[model samples]
Target: MEARLDLAGSPVAGKALKHFIAANTALAGSTLPRATRELVEIRASQINGCGFCVDMHTKDAAHAGESALRLNLVAAWREATVFTEAERAALELAEQGTRIADAGGGVTDEAWAKAAEHYDEDQLAALVSLIALINAFNRLNVIVRRPAGDYRPGQFD
Candidate 1:
Protein backbone atom coordinates (compact mmCIF):
# COMPACT_ATOMS: atom_id res chain seq x y z
CA MET A 1 0.00 0.00 0.00
CA GLU A 2 1.01 3.57 -0.64
CA ALA A 3 0.59 6.58 1.60
CA ARG A 4 -1.81 9.19 0.18
CA LEU A 5 1.04 11.64 0.41
CA ASP A 6 4.66 11.59 1.43
CA LEU A 7 4.58 13.71 4.55
CA ALA A 8 8.33 14.37 4.40
CA GLY A 9 8.14 15.58 0.81
CA SER A 10 5.36 18.09 1.34
CA PRO A 11 6.62 21.46 2.53
CA VAL A 12 3.64 22.09 4.75
CA ALA A 13 3.60 18.67 6.38
CA GLY A 14 7.37 18.63 6.57
CA LYS A 15 7.53 21.94 8.39
CA ALA A 16 4.89 20.86 10.85
CA LEU A 17 6.57 17.51 11.41
CA LYS A 18 9.93 19.18 11.95
CA HIS A 19 8.48 21.16 14.81
CA PHE A 20 6.70 18.09 16.05
CA ILE A 21 9.96 16.15 16.07
CA ALA A 22 11.69 18.99 17.88
CA ALA A 23 8.95 18.98 20.49
CA ASN A 24 9.29 15.24 20.84
CA THR A 25 13.04 15.53 21.32
CA ALA A 26 12.53 18.00 24.12
CA LEU A 27 9.97 15.73 25.71
CA ALA A 28 12.39 12.83 25.41
CA GLY A 29 14.76 14.60 27.73
CA SER A 30 12.12 14.82 30.43
CA THR A 31 12.13 12.65 33.54
CA LEU A 32 9.39 10.39 32.25
CA PRO A 33 10.91 6.92 32.06
CA ARG A 34 11.78 5.78 28.56
CA ALA A 35 9.99 2.47 29.03
CA THR A 36 6.80 4.18 30.10
CA ARG A 37 7.02 6.52 27.13
CA GLU A 38 7.19 3.65 24.66
CA LEU A 39 4.37 1.77 26.37
CA VAL A 40 2.16 4.82 26.33
CA GLU A 41 2.92 5.47 22.67
CA ILE A 42 2.17 1.86 21.77
CA ARG A 43 -1.05 1.81 23.75
CA ALA A 44 -2.33 5.03 22.24
CA SER A 45 -1.51 3.83 18.76
CA GLN A 46 -3.28 0.58 19.46
CA ILE A 47 -6.39 2.45 20.55
CA ASN A 48 -6.24 4.68 17.49
CA GLY A 49 -5.68 1.68 15.18
CA CYS A 50 -2.58 3.26 13.77
CA GLY A 51 -0.76 0.17 12.56
CA PHE A 52 2.28 2.12 11.44
CA CYS A 53 2.83 3.59 14.90
CA VAL A 54 2.09 0.31 16.60
CA ASP A 55 4.76 -1.28 14.50
CA MET A 56 7.27 1.52 15.04
CA HIS A 57 6.84 1.82 18.79
CA THR A 58 6.69 -1.91 19.39
CA LYS A 59 9.92 -2.39 17.53
CA ASP A 60 11.48 0.55 19.29
CA ALA A 61 10.36 -0.80 22.65
CA ALA A 62 11.78 -4.18 21.89
CA HIS A 63 15.05 -2.67 20.82
CA ALA A 64 15.11 -0.79 24.06
CA GLY A 65 14.84 -4.08 26.00
CA GLU A 66 11.11 -4.11 26.67
CA SER A 67 9.97 -7.65 27.24
CA ALA A 68 7.94 -9.38 24.59
CA LEU A 69 5.34 -10.35 27.17
CA ARG A 70 4.90 -6.77 28.26
CA LEU A 71 4.69 -5.55 24.68
CA ASN A 72 2.01 -8.10 23.88
CA LEU A 73 0.05 -7.17 26.98
CA VAL A 74 -0.05 -3.39 26.57
CA ALA A 75 -3.56 -3.50 25.13
CA ALA A 76 -4.75 -5.42 28.18
CA TRP A 77 -2.59 -3.54 30.65
CA ARG A 78 -5.41 -3.17 33.16
CA GLU A 79 -5.49 -6.93 33.59
CA ALA A 80 -1.79 -7.47 33.28
CA THR A 81 0.52 -7.98 36.23
CA VAL A 82 3.79 -7.06 34.54
CA PHE A 83 3.31 -3.30 34.79
CA THR A 84 4.43 -1.16 37.70
CA GLU A 85 2.00 1.17 39.50
CA ALA A 86 3.59 4.18 37.80
CA GLU A 87 3.30 2.53 34.43
CA ARG A 88 -0.32 1.65 35.13
CA ALA A 89 -1.11 5.22 36.02
CA ALA A 90 0.54 6.42 32.81
CA LEU A 91 -1.42 3.88 30.80
CA GLU A 92 -4.68 5.05 32.34
CA LEU A 93 -3.82 8.61 31.46
CA ALA A 94 -2.88 7.62 27.92
CA GLU A 95 -6.21 5.84 27.48
CA GLN A 96 -8.25 8.71 28.81
CA GLY A 97 -6.27 11.20 26.79
CA THR A 98 -6.53 9.21 23.58
CA ARG A 99 -10.23 8.58 23.93
CA ILE A 100 -11.11 12.13 24.80
CA ALA A 101 -14.11 12.31 22.46
CA ASP A 102 -15.51 9.03 23.73
CA ALA A 103 -15.27 10.20 27.34
CA GLY A 104 -16.54 13.72 26.43
CA GLY A 105 -14.52 15.67 29.03
CA GLY A 106 -11.00 14.50 28.24
CA VAL A 107 -8.57 13.25 30.88
CA THR A 108 -10.26 12.78 34.22
CA ASP A 109 -9.02 14.40 37.39
CA GLU A 110 -8.68 11.01 38.99
CA ALA A 111 -6.44 9.83 36.22
CA TRP A 112 -4.38 13.01 36.37
CA ALA A 113 -4.02 12.67 40.10
CA LYS A 114 -2.92 9.10 39.78
CA ALA A 115 -0.30 10.12 37.31
CA ALA A 116 0.72 13.02 39.49
CA GLU A 117 1.42 10.64 42.32
CA HIS A 118 4.05 9.01 40.15
CA TYR A 119 5.51 11.85 38.12
CA ASP A 120 7.10 15.22 38.82
CA GLU A 121 5.81 18.38 37.15
CA ASP A 122 8.33 18.15 34.32
CA GLN A 123 7.56 14.48 33.81
CA LEU A 124 3.85 15.24 33.70
CA ALA A 125 4.46 17.85 31.06
CA ALA A 126 6.41 15.36 28.97
CA LEU A 127 3.78 12.69 29.44
CA VAL A 128 1.07 15.01 28.23
CA SER A 129 3.10 16.15 25.23
CA LEU A 130 3.98 12.59 24.29
CA ILE A 131 0.33 11.59 24.33
CA ALA A 132 -0.61 14.47 22.05
CA LEU A 133 2.33 13.87 19.75
CA ILE A 134 1.63 10.19 19.34
CA ASN A 135 -2.03 10.82 18.68
CA ALA A 136 -1.19 13.33 15.98
CA PHE A 137 1.13 10.83 14.31
CA ASN A 138 -1.51 8.14 14.67
CA ARG A 139 -4.18 10.20 12.96
CA LEU A 140 -1.84 11.16 10.16
CA ASN A 141 -0.84 7.55 9.54
CA VAL A 142 -4.35 6.20 9.88
CA ILE A 143 -5.75 8.75 7.49
CA VAL A 144 -3.11 7.85 4.94
CA ARG A 145 -3.62 4.12 5.47
CA ARG A 146 0.13 3.72 5.92
CA PRO A 147 1.17 0.13 5.74
CA ALA A 148 2.77 -1.51 8.75
CA GLY A 149 5.32 -4.22 9.69
CA ASP A 150 8.35 -2.79 7.95
CA TYR A 151 9.61 -0.42 10.63
CA ARG A 152 13.04 -0.96 12.17
CA PRO A 153 14.12 0.18 15.58
CA GLY A 154 15.64 3.67 15.48
CA GLN A 155 14.57 4.06 11.86
CA PHE A 156 13.68 7.69 12.41
CA ASP A 157 16.60 8.57 14.64
Candidate 2:
Protein backbone atom coordinates (compact mmCIF):
# COMPACT_ATOMS: atom_id res chain seq x y z
CA MET A 1 0.00 0.00 0.00
CA GLU A 2 1.10 3.53 -0.72
CA ALA A 3 1.31 6.14 2.00
CA ARG A 4 -1.36 8.82 2.08
CA LEU A 5 1.41 11.36 1.72
CA ASP A 6 5.12 11.29 1.22
CA LEU A 7 6.34 12.86 4.43
CA ALA A 8 9.76 13.55 2.98
CA GLY A 9 8.32 15.33 -0.04
CA SER A 10 6.06 17.66 1.82
CA PRO A 11 7.93 20.83 2.74
CA VAL A 12 6.21 21.22 6.11
CA ALA A 13 6.53 17.58 7.06
CA GLY A 14 10.09 17.49 5.87
CA LYS A 15 11.00 20.44 8.05
CA ALA A 16 9.27 19.01 11.10
CA LEU A 17 10.75 15.59 10.56
CA LYS A 18 14.22 17.09 10.30
CA HIS A 19 13.92 18.34 13.83
CA PHE A 20 12.33 15.13 14.99
CA ILE A 21 15.16 13.17 13.47
CA ALA A 22 17.68 15.41 15.16
CA ALA A 23 15.99 14.90 18.50
CA ASN A 24 16.05 11.18 17.95
CA THR A 25 19.75 11.32 17.17
CA ALA A 26 20.46 13.21 20.36
CA LEU A 27 18.43 10.73 22.34
CA ALA A 28 20.40 7.92 20.76
CA GLY A 29 23.55 9.33 22.34
CA SER A 30 21.99 9.38 25.80
CA THR A 31 23.17 7.32 28.73
CA LEU A 32 20.58 4.67 27.89
CA PRO A 33 22.07 1.52 26.46
CA ARG A 34 21.71 1.00 22.73
CA ALA A 35 20.03 -2.36 23.22
CA THR A 36 17.55 -0.91 25.66
CA ARG A 37 16.76 1.97 23.34
CA GLU A 38 16.06 -0.34 20.43
CA LEU A 39 13.96 -2.59 22.63
CA VAL A 40 11.99 0.38 23.89
CA GLU A 41 11.42 1.61 20.36
CA ILE A 42 10.31 -1.83 19.23
CA ARG A 43 7.97 -2.31 22.17
CA ALA A 44 6.41 1.11 21.71
CA SER A 45 5.99 0.57 18.00
CA GLN A 46 4.39 -2.80 18.65
CA ILE A 47 1.94 -1.25 21.07
CA ASN A 48 1.09 1.51 18.61
CA GLY A 49 0.75 -0.93 15.74
CA CYS A 50 3.20 0.98 13.62
CA GLY A 51 4.52 -1.60 11.23
CA PHE A 52 7.01 0.78 9.68
CA CYS A 53 8.68 1.46 13.00
CA VAL A 54 8.44 -2.14 14.15
CA ASP A 55 10.15 -3.23 10.95
CA MET A 56 12.73 -0.50 11.08
CA HIS A 57 13.65 -0.96 14.74
CA THR A 58 13.74 -4.74 14.53
CA LYS A 59 16.06 -4.59 11.56
CA ASP A 60 18.19 -1.94 13.22
CA ALA A 61 18.36 -3.99 16.38
CA ALA A 62 19.48 -7.00 14.42
CA HIS A 63 22.19 -4.95 12.76
CA ALA A 64 23.36 -3.94 16.21
CA GLY A 65 23.72 -7.61 17.23
CA GLU A 66 20.33 -8.20 18.82
CA SER A 67 19.35 -11.83 18.66
CA ALA A 68 16.36 -13.14 16.71
CA LEU A 69 14.99 -14.76 19.85
CA ARG A 70 15.03 -11.49 21.79
CA LEU A 71 13.62 -9.50 18.88
CA ASN A 72 10.85 -12.04 18.36
CA LEU A 73 10.01 -12.01 22.05
CA VAL A 74 9.72 -8.23 22.31
CA ALA A 75 5.98 -8.39 21.72
CA ALA A 76 5.56 -10.77 24.62
CA TRP A 77 8.40 -9.40 26.70
CA ARG A 78 6.59 -9.67 29.99
CA GLU A 79 6.42 -13.42 29.73
CA ALA A 80 9.74 -13.81 27.97
CA THR A 81 12.76 -14.89 29.99
CA VAL A 82 15.40 -13.52 27.63
CA PHE A 83 15.34 -10.00 29.00
CA THR A 84 17.10 -8.54 32.02
CA GLU A 85 15.30 -6.68 34.81
CA ALA A 86 16.40 -3.33 33.39
CA GLU A 87 15.16 -4.24 29.95
CA ARG A 88 11.88 -5.44 31.40
CA ALA A 89 11.45 -2.20 33.28
CA ALA A 90 12.09 -0.19 30.15
CA LEU A 91 9.57 -2.28 28.25
CA GLU A 92 6.99 -1.77 30.99
CA LEU A 93 7.54 1.97 30.87
CA ALA A 94 7.28 1.95 27.08
CA GLU A 95 3.97 0.09 27.23
CA GLN A 96 2.57 2.41 29.84
CA GLY A 97 3.75 5.45 27.92
CA THR A 98 2.30 4.20 24.65
CA ARG A 99 -1.07 3.31 26.21
CA ILE A 100 -1.39 6.58 28.04
CA ALA A 101 -4.87 7.28 26.71
CA ASP A 102 -6.12 3.88 27.82
CA ALA A 103 -4.60 4.20 31.25
CA GLY A 104 -6.05 7.69 31.83
CA GLY A 105 -3.45 8.60 34.43
CA GLY A 106 -0.55 7.80 32.11
CA VAL A 107 2.58 6.08 33.41
CA THR A 108 1.97 4.85 36.91
CA ASP A 109 4.07 5.55 39.97
CA GLU A 110 4.92 1.89 40.22
CA ALA A 111 6.14 1.82 36.67
CA TRP A 112 8.14 4.97 37.20
CA ALA A 113 9.62 3.62 40.38
CA LYS A 114 10.53 0.36 38.74
CA ALA A 115 12.21 2.16 35.89
CA ALA A 116 14.06 4.37 38.33
CA GLU A 117 15.32 1.30 40.08
CA HIS A 118 16.93 0.13 36.88
CA TYR A 119 17.97 3.42 35.26
CA ASP A 120 19.62 6.55 36.50
CA GLU A 121 18.18 10.03 35.97
CA ASP A 122 19.93 10.45 32.62
CA GLN A 123 18.81 7.07 31.39
CA LEU A 124 15.28 7.78 32.56
CA ALA A 125 15.33 11.02 30.63
CA ALA A 126 16.39 9.15 27.53
CA LEU A 127 13.69 6.55 28.08
CA VAL A 128 10.99 9.18 28.44
CA SER A 129 12.14 11.00 25.33
CA LEU A 130 12.42 7.77 23.39
CA ILE A 131 8.88 6.76 24.29
CA ALA A 132 7.41 10.08 23.24
CA LEU A 133 9.46 10.20 20.06
CA ILE A 134 8.60 6.66 18.95
CA ASN A 135 4.92 7.29 19.64
CA ALA A 136 5.05 10.36 17.43
CA PHE A 137 6.71 8.45 14.61
CA ASN A 138 4.23 5.61 15.08
CA ARG A 139 1.20 7.90 14.82
CA LEU A 140 2.61 9.61 11.76
CA ASN A 141 3.41 6.39 9.93
CA VAL A 142 0.21 4.62 10.95
CA ILE A 143 -1.93 7.61 9.94
CA VAL A 144 -0.32 7.65 6.52
CA ARG A 145 -0.63 3.89 6.13
CA ARG A 146 3.07 3.65 5.39
CA PRO A 147 3.94 0.16 4.25
CA ALA A 148 6.79 -1.66 5.92
CA GLY A 149 9.50 -4.17 4.86
CA ASP A 150 11.66 -1.88 2.77
CA TYR A 151 13.68 -0.37 5.59
CA ARG A 152 17.42 -1.05 5.72
CA PRO A 153 19.51 -0.63 8.79
CA GLY A 154 21.04 2.88 8.89
CA GLN A 155 19.11 3.87 5.79
CA PHE A 156 18.25 7.18 7.37
CA ASP A 157 21.80 7.79 8.51
TM per candidate: 0.98, 0.98
Clash list (residue pairs), candidate 2: none
For all candidates, what are the clash counts?
0, 0
The superposed Cα distance between candidate 1 and the true structure at residue 37, in angstroms, equals: 0.3
* lDDT: worst 10-residue window of model 1: 1-10
TM-score, candidate 1, is: 0.98
Could you tell me how far off, in angstroms, the CA of residue 85 lies in candidate 1 after the best superposition?
0.5
Write model 2 residue lDDT over 56-144, tens digit each, in one string.
99999999999999999999998999999999999999999999989888999999999999999999999999999999999999999
